[model samples]
Structure formats: structure tokens, C-alpha cells
Target chain A: MADQYTIHFGILGCANIARKVSRAIKLAPNCTLSAIGSRSIEKASKFAKENEYPDSIKVYGSYDAVLDDPDVDAVYIPLPTSLHVKWAVLAAEKKKHVLLEKPVALNLKDLDIILEACENNGVQYMDATMWMHHPRTTQMRGFLSDAHRFGQLKAVHSVFSYLGGDDFLKNDIRVQPDLDALGALGDVGWYCIRAILWANDYEMPKAVTAWREPEYNEAGVILSCGASLRFEDGKQASFYCSFLSNLTMDISALGTRGNLRVHDFVIPFQENLGPFYVTANSGWVGMSIGCDPPPTEHLIKTDLPQEALMVMEFSKLVKNIKVNGVAPERKWTSISRKTQVVVDAVIASIGKGFVPIEIN
Target chain B: MADQYTIHFGILGCANIARKVSRAIKLAPNCTLSAIGSRSIEKASKFAKENEYPDSIKVYGSYDAVLDDPDVDAVYIPLPTSLHVKWAVLAAEKKKHVLLEKPVALNLKDLDIILEACENNGVQYMDATMWMHHPRTTQMRGFLSDAHRFGQLKAVHSVFSYLGGDDFLKNDIRVQPDLDALGALGDVGWYCIRAILWANDYEMPKAVTAWREPEYNEAGVILSCGASLRFEDGKQASFYCSFLSNLTMDISALGTRGNLRVHDFVIPFQENLGPFYVTANSGWVGMSIGCDPPPTEHLIKTDLPQEALMVMEFSKLVKNIKVNGVAPERKWTSISRKTQVVVDAVIASIGKGFVPIEIN
Candidate 1:
């Protein structure tokens, strides 16, 4: 049943997120879950068994074994942020394509080490930001890009937050200073920052200023924070991220002629369809007591889950590089880099007494 | 048909907003539009005819004549912001309850002058923020107040904007400093600030900071602006208001256990019903790929429009004061003062190079 065009993916770590991505790999038509590796043989074996992985799937005790597998065409790195550079670069050096988890590295300096290795090895690199592959995202982008419908962009507000509860607050790796380091900003804020960038067509803000108040945990990890981004042409954006609040993911973009809002931007409430609202050319009705046209709801249906689509898209690129001799796509790497740059700026601004940090 | 309990209202100016309030007065069961006043009898007479007012409605050549009419129980002032202190004080001095349009005055100092007059005359004072009377607002407040459902507030983000277009931007009274000195901040930002305060149960923020790069008109009046408010308990709020963007009125509030959102917070899309969304205790479904318990849309129905409800509430207070000799409700005046204080602080923050202005 195996096809030559199918890309075999080896998950580098059995992190909780890997379980979802592994399912995505299985769901993707062009990819198969070839291998999984944890720190120990027992851990890897237990994970594979618990997830009901097929007997044909390889289980390796050490990550090096996964990279050494001849059939592994791509490696999905879901290691902690501090360990990303070491493992991701090793996977690229081994001639395996890299699909790294977000907050790719602790900062840009380490991220460059990973990117340079991937480029030198002639392999595709993409961050595992699953929402980018959602069909609803593309449709929303169409609305935002329309000149007559949306007009010139003026302001955007985004929020991504969820209450992690007391157990997660105390025991989660995200709250461990040395493991994730960036904490809420790296985990949830990464999504918010990516959303703002996506809305602005990947254009970097001129400057970013963090809000004055940021809640920190005992280990000095940010639990909640927010920032405002200013553009050269007067377009503005602001985002708030927290691990101390109930689940809320929203994006509100205002344009000269229209506005768009998505309440569940990070993950759709239902996997089958994603919904958004658009109000175009609205005006006052009857002495300004009410609005003329209400925002229309748009629901985009997808046969494949967004994560599966992401895996499928990544596999297509890997297949292109292997069979057709096409160069690796650079767009994914560019977006990841820009997102990390803003993340760095926000942290820097917060560190500098809430001063505005100029984007490079 | 008028009864002793019915409150008679006099319109002090023929501003465009007055058209809406006049309809509200007529729709309110306990209120009757008794008089209309402008600079000249011709303007007042023409307005009365165009609106198809009954011949029993008095047309006053001057505002003083309406104030002199002993039958008028309350004065609804939709005059320019600059004229509020003058007319509001005069109306209050005549022992007339004042229903003033927002931004109640240019600043807190001027607003205090008007408030003091109302208090001295023992007449109720209320700002014309119609959305406060929407049934949906009361329901949303119930959710926020529920300790187990919404929990303590963490953040609030609001926006109120409309594209005023070319001619309105150039010639509208809102853009004229002499007429509405606060411009978009007073006109639209008032609602956002009020919403923020309302979400926090009228607890004022400790300090406010304006975002950098506020767009301004040629007359030095702000066309678009945003600000962040920080509370003593680490709660945060931010809002954006503009005359350069599409019609958008939104309020997103995040709490420890739940979140609340409304798209059309200022004016509902449909006149008879308003909608809001609440997602309580949401969590990950299937390895965080999607959310559990999607936000439920709540459509609050109302037989009376929000403005009419506002009129009804104002008239009820007037009737209570007139019939039962009950003291004027200080709650409305206090809320208006708090909103004005925040407005003044936002302007002060913007003026001081986007510095944080402490709210005292």
C-alpha cells in the first residue's frame, strides 16, 4: 500500500503535542507516521501502545535512532524550547526535513543556528503553527485583501488566553523557566503574534511596546501579558495572551470600508467547520439608532482537519523536493522568523520598563 | 392622554442626535415630547413639521423659552460639547432633570460644573448612553458578576469606530474643535471607556496610557486613538476609537473562568434584539485540537428599543423624584463622572507624549 511519493515522518519527542501531530500525520494522505522516539525505550514503547499506533510504526528509544532511519524523510521536533536548536539542526544535518514546534528557539540567535543548518542541508523548514493551513484562514485572508470590501487596514485586536488551572500552573513545562523560558508569551502569545502578522500580510510592525503589567509566576515565567504594535503607515495592532484566563481566542480587524472578526481563531469549536463574521460598508439606520447591515457569518467547511492539512501541505513540499527537484519553500521559514523577531521585541520592551522596541 | 406620572421633556437643540432621542421620548410610555427649541422659531417649527409632530407639541423660538415652560419636567440636551456646561447648568438651575448626550463635557472639570448644578437643584442627572439600557447588557452583567461562571476579570478590550467619509470628516460638528472639542475620543471613545468601566463594575483603573501615533485632523482634534488602562488589582483594559475605520463596536472581556463578547455593543444590528457570546470553563477536546463547549450565542429580545428604554429609565427617575419626593439617583451621576474622568485622562495621556496618566 506504500507509495514512493509518500513522506515518512519521525516524531523527535513524545511530548503531549506530538500525539496530535502524529494523528495528523496518519490522517494526511501523503504522509505516514514512520517513527517515534522518547528519552527512553520504555517511554517510547508505552506512548506508541497507549496511542494505539500500528505495529508497523517504528519505536526508537533515543531520538538519534529516529534520525538515523533511512525511511524517515521528515522529522517533527516537539522538544522543549531550550533543546530545539540542538535537535532541529541535527535532524537537518542528517538530511531530514524539519517541522519544528513553535517558539522555535529561545531567541533569534538560536533560531538562526537551526535555520542556517536547514538551508545548508537543502531541506524544507516549517514551524508547526497548524492554523495557517486552515481553509477558513485562507477565506478570511481573501476578505482582508479585498480593496473594495475591506479597504485600507486601520486597527486590529487579537487575544489568545486559557486558564491552565493550579496543577498546570505549578507543574507544566511551560511554567518551568528553563524549559519554555518565554512561558505564556511563547506558548499562547506566539499564536496571537502570528495572527497579527498574518492579518497585516506578514508586514513587520515599526515598533512594539509591551503593556506595563505582566503577571509572573514563582519561577519568573510570564503568566499574562499584552503589547501594542505600531506601523509606519499608521496601521495599529494589539494583542493579549494569558495562561491565567479562560479560553478565548479572537481577532478583530478594522478596515476603512469593512471589518472582520473571528471568535475562535486558534482552534475551531468544531473540527468540521470554522466560522467568522464580516460586516462590509455598514452604516447607521434610522437616525443612527441602529446599524444598517449586520455582520454576516461565514462558515468554511473542511474535509481534513487543519492539522492534517498542515501535514499534507508539508508532505507535498517534501515530495516536490525529492521527486521533482524543486527548491525548498522559504515562505514558512520567513514567517517563523518574523514572528520570533516580534516575540523578542516584546520581551525586550517588557524588560526595558515598557519602552517601545524598534523592529529590525 | 398624558397623566400626572408622565414626564414631559424639552429638546434644547436640534442636533442630529436629537432626532433619535425625540423618537425615543415618544416611544417611552412614561415620557412625552412637550417642546422643541432652537435659535429661531423657523428652525424649530420646520423640525416639528418634518418629524410630523402633533400640533400640541410646543415650538420655542429660544431655548430659554423651553426652560421657562413650567410644564417641562426634564431637558434633553444634545448641544455641542462646548455648550454643555452653559445649558446644562441653566437647565439644572431651573430645577429640570438633565439627560445630557455623551461625552457629557469636554473634561471632568466642566462636567463637575454641570453635576454640581444638578445636585444643588436636587434634579437627576444622566448621560444619554443608550446601550446601558439594552437588556443584553444587563444579562451580560449577570454573567460577569457570577463568581463561579465568569470569575475575576483579567482583561477587557473594546472598540467603537465608523468611517465618517470625506464630507463628514471635513465638515461634521464632531471634527470641529469649537463644537465638539474632544472629537472622536468624546463621540465614540466614550462608549468604549464606559463599557470597560461597566465590565469592572464601575471600578476605576489606577492609570491610563495612550497608544503612540494617534491620527489627528487638521483642527488638532483626534480622528483616531487608543489607550490602555491598568487597575490596582492587575486587571487591564484597552480600547480603540476612530473616525477613519469601518463601523465596528465590540467588547471582549476575559476572566479567570469565562469570557464575554459582543459585536454591536453600542447599537445592535437588529433593533428588537441584541446578541452576545459567552464561553464558560472551556477546555481542549482531543489533545487540544479543538475546544469543548463552543461559545453560546445569546439573543436578548426587547419589545422597546434600547434608546426608548433609556428614555423610560430616565423618566422613571424623574417621576420618582416628582411623585414620591425620593432623592435623585446619584448612581447615574457617579458613573458619568467616572467615564468623564477616564476621558480626561486619555486626553492628558495623549498630550503628554503617550505617558501614563494617573486617575485621581
Candidate 2:
């Protein structure tokens, strides 16, 4: 029943996140899960069975087998941050399109190496930030772009935090230096940084300064942190990410003419609809006792989950490159690198005693 | 039919804010608008007529006459910032309970002078920050204090801004160096600093740092600015106040177990009720695609307006001093001084090129 345009996908890990992505691949009409691989054959087989993959899906004991599968047109790499460079580079070298998990690499240096491999192999590359593909995000963008609705942006503040309980603090790979060294900043701060950049049209900040007194685990992995970014035109953005607070994902962007607030930016409160609030040309009423027109709430409905839309979008790009003989889209790669640049600057600023790091 | 405990209030200066506070005094059950004074007798008489004050109200050509009135148990001074030290101190010295408008004084030094005058004369002193008396504010404090619902506070962010338009930027007393001097910071930022301190239970931040590139008028009065504050317990707060943006007032407080968001902190979107959002012990659900429990919106209804409540509270203090022979309430003076201390530090930080200013 598979169409000729459907991209055959291979998943290169049995991580918990892979379960969600596997479902997304199934939901995406242009993508089909062809194979899955893990270090342990039994684990891969069990994951396929538990996730209800059909008999046509292939199971392999090693990630290399998935990359080597000639039938696979693309690979979704959800391995740990430390393992991304090794598997993603190899997948790209094998001419399979790559969908890499975030904090894509430990630093920009490692990310550059992986990006270079994809460029050389002419493989489509994109990071798996699902929220970017949401229909609500597009709606919010339209408001921000309209000069009458939202004029020149003046400031943006975002917060992405959740109380990752005792078990996560002690045993999670995210808190382990060898696996996800950046910890909360990498795991949660990545989305905050990405949201800031996305709101700013991917323009890199002129400078980045990390807030002082970041909390760290015994392993020296950051448990919570915040940073401020300053753009060239005096526009500013600040974000806080933590594994020690209640669940909150908020983005408040203030412009000359309008204000936009999305309380559930990284993840919506409901799966089917995402809501955002916007107020344009708002002013005071009745001796400054109340506002004339309060912020209006707009809810966007989606037929499929945001993650599936991400997969569908990536697969469309892959199909264009494979079936139409076109080059891979460069937009995703550019924005991903820009986000990593700010992350690196924040880390650098923290390293140097909370001093501001100049961006070039 | 006036009660024996009713406090008679005389307002000094016919500033725009006085119009609202004058109405509030009439609305307050235990207060009566007995007198009003401006530099021009016609202006004072016209304001009394326009605001529909009772026939018994007195109109004086000079603020000194209002302060000199023996029947005026309390004097509300809505004079400009530069004139606050003069009129407020004189009003207190005249043995009238001093209800001064904010930026209570140009600095704590001046505020101290006014406080000493009130102390030496045995009169209550309170700033005219109306929102502080809102019933919704008390409800929010309850949430922040709940150990089970909202644990130890981690961070707070507040913003207060309004587009003052070209005429205000050019001609308003707030933008004139010799009149308001502190400009937007004194007018709008005052509320933001107070909100941050209110959220932190009035615990002062040890250090304050202003953000870079504060927009200023040609007279060198701040039009917009932001600052970050760090407390001794590692709790942090940041706020932005502007006169060049759409009207927006928001406060977000994040604790270990809960998050509190108030979209309109300075003034509610509606006059009769104020709404706030809170989420306690929230977490992800169903593959981290949505939040388990969404934030609950709480609307607090108020009988009289917040400004009227403020006048009533101030009058209660005045009557206690007059009838019950109790010492003037030090709580209002203490918090007002604390707020002034932070405001002085923010201005000092900006003066020093965005360097951190230690509170001590």
C-alpha cells in the first residue's frame, strides 16, 4: 500500500524518544519506518514488537546495519548527544538523510563535523525540534511579521522548565557527563534558545551572557541555568531552563505595536489544539484602571501531531532530493547552526565567570 | 451622615493621576475628598467641577493651603517627582498623613527626609501604588506562600510598559529632567520593582544590574530600561519598563513546585475582576506531547476599585493614629523604603554603565 513517493526510513536507536518518533513516522504519509537497530538485537526486536511495527519492518542488532540497509532512504538518529557525531556522520556518509536529536553535538565543533559530512554526501539534514513544525507556530509567526499587528520586536522572554524528579536527577543519561554533558542546558535550554532564535528570525545575537549561580549536579552537569542575548538593533531575549521547577514553557515577545504570549510553546497543553494570545495597539482604559482590549486567544487545530508534521516535512525534502534530483534544503542546517552558536556562547560566558561573550 | 472615623483627604497638585485618586477618595467608605489645590485656582475649581465633587469640597489656589487645612486629616500628594520631597515633607510636617505618589522621592535620601518628617510629626506615610491593595494581589500572595502548592521561589520576571505617544515623550512632566527626572523608571518601573519585591516577600536583592542600551529622551530621561536583581538565597528577578511600547503589565513567578502568571499586574484587563494563572506540580503526559494538568485561571472579584481600597487602607491607618492613639504603621514605611532602595540601585547601575550595584 506504500506510495512511490514514500521515503523509506531507518531509526538508529531504541531510546525512549524513538518510540514517539516511530509513531510519528507511521503517522506521516510520506514516510514509512523500514528498519530499526539497537546495540542489542533482543532490545530492537522487543521495541519493534512493543511499538507494533509490521512484519515488513527490519530489525538489526547494530546501528551500522540500519545505515547500511540499501532499502532505507533516510535515518532518524535519536542516540545520546555523545553518540550523535559517530552515527549521524556514518549515516550521512552512507547517503542516507539524517534527522538528528538535539543538542545535536557537544559543541559547534562536533556539530560542524557532522554538518560537513552531510554536505559532502548531499544528504538532507534536520534537527528533531517538533514544535517548530506546529501549525500554531506558523500562526504566531504571521502575527510577529505583520507590522501593524506586531511591530519591530523589542524583547522576548522564554522559560522551559519541568521538575525532573529524584529518579531523573540521579540516574538519567541527561545528568550523566559522559552521555549528555550539557545536562539541563542541553536537554531543556536547547528549546528555549531555539525559541528565542525562532522569534528573532534566526538572527544571531551580538552578545550572550549567562546568568550567574547556575545549579549543577555532582557530576558537574548543569541542572538549571539562564542566559540573556542582545541583538545588534537593541532587541533582546532572555531564557531560563531548569530540571528543578514545575512544568512551564512560555514565550512572551513584546513589540512596539503588539504583544504575543504562548504559555505552552515547547509542548501544548492539549495535543489537538495550540493556543496563543496576542494584543495589538492595546492601551489603557478608564483612568488607567483597565486595558481597553485585552489579549485575544487564538487556537490552532492540527490533524496530526506536531512530531508527525516534522517527519512529513523532512521526508518531503528527502523525496525532492532523491526523486527530483534537487539539492537538500539549507534552511534547517543554517538555523540549527545559529542556535548551537548561541548555546556555545552561553556556555563560554558561564565558563568565564558570567562575563558577556561577543558573537561574530 | 459621615461616620466619626471618616478621614478627610485633601489632594495637592492637579496632575492627571490626582483625578483618579480624588475619585477613589470619594469612593472609599471611610474617606471623603474634602479639599483640592493646584497652582491655579481656576484649575482646582474646574477639576472639582469636572470630577463632580460634592459642594462641601474646598478649592485652594496653592498646595500649601491644602496642607495647612486643619480639617484635612490626610493629604494626597500627586506632585511631580522633583516636587515630592518639598510638598510631601511639608505635608508631613503640617501633621497630615502623607499619601505621596511614586517615585516616592528622587532617592532614598530624599525619601528618608520625608519619612523623618512623618516620624517627627507622628503621621502615617504611604505611597499611592493602588494595585498593591487589590484583593487579587492578596490571593496571589497566598499561592506564593503555599509550601505544598508553590515551593521555594526560584525566579520572577515582571514587565510594565505603555506607549506614551509623541506628545507625552516631548511634553509630559515625566520626560522632563527638571520635573520627574527619573522618567519611565520612576513612573512605570516603580510598579515593576514593587511587584518583584512583593513576590519575594519584600526580601531585597543583594545586587542589581541594569540592561544595556536604555532608550532615553533628548532631555536624558529614561524612556525604557530593564534590570536584573540577585538575592542572597540565589532567587533572582528581572523586569523591563518602557514608555515606548504597547501597554503591557505582566508578572511571572516560578517556584520549585508551581508557576504563577499574572498578565495584568499593574492594572487588570477588566475593572471588576483580576485573573491570574497558576500551575502546581505540573508535568508532561503521553510521550511528553502535552502537559498533564494545565494551568488553572483564577479570577478575583473586587467590590470597590483597587485605588479605592488603597485609600480605605490608608484611611484606616490614619484613623487608628487619630482615634485609637496607636503609633503610625511602620509596615507601609518599611516596604516603601525597601522599594525605593531597589529603584536607587537600578538608577545607580545604569549610571555606572550597566555594572552591578551591591545593595549594601
Top candidate, metric lDDT? 1
Residue A78, model 1, lDDT: 93
Q: Pick the candidate with the highest DockQ.
A: 1
Give the lDDT of residue B257 in candidate 1: 94
Q: What does candidate 1's lDDT look like per residue over A147-253, in tens digits?
A: 99899899999999999989898789898998999999999999999999999999999999999889988889999999999987788999999999999999999
Task: Encode model 2's per-residue lDDT on B1-360: one tens digit a residue.
Answer: 467899999999888888889888888899898899999999999998988888899999999899889999999998899998899889888899999899898899999999999999999999999899999999999999999899989889899988888999989999999989889999999999999999999998988888877889898999988888888666778898999888889999999999999999888889889999999988778777778688899999998989999999999999999999999999999999999999999999889877788988
Candidate 2 residue runs with Cα over 4 Å from true position: none
Deviation of model 2 at B242, angstroms: 0.9
Could you tell me how far off, in angstroms, the CA of residue B30 lies in candidate 1 after the best superposition? 1.3
Error of 1 at A132 (Å): 0.2
Candidate 2's TM-score: 0.98
Candidate 1, residues B270-336, lDDT tens digits: the string is 8998999998998999888889888899999999999999999999999999999999999999999
Cα-based lDDT at residue B309, candidate 2? 97
lDDT of 1 at A236: 90
lDDT of 2 at A258: 93
Assess each model's interface with DockQ, reporting 2 decimals per model: 0.86, 0.76
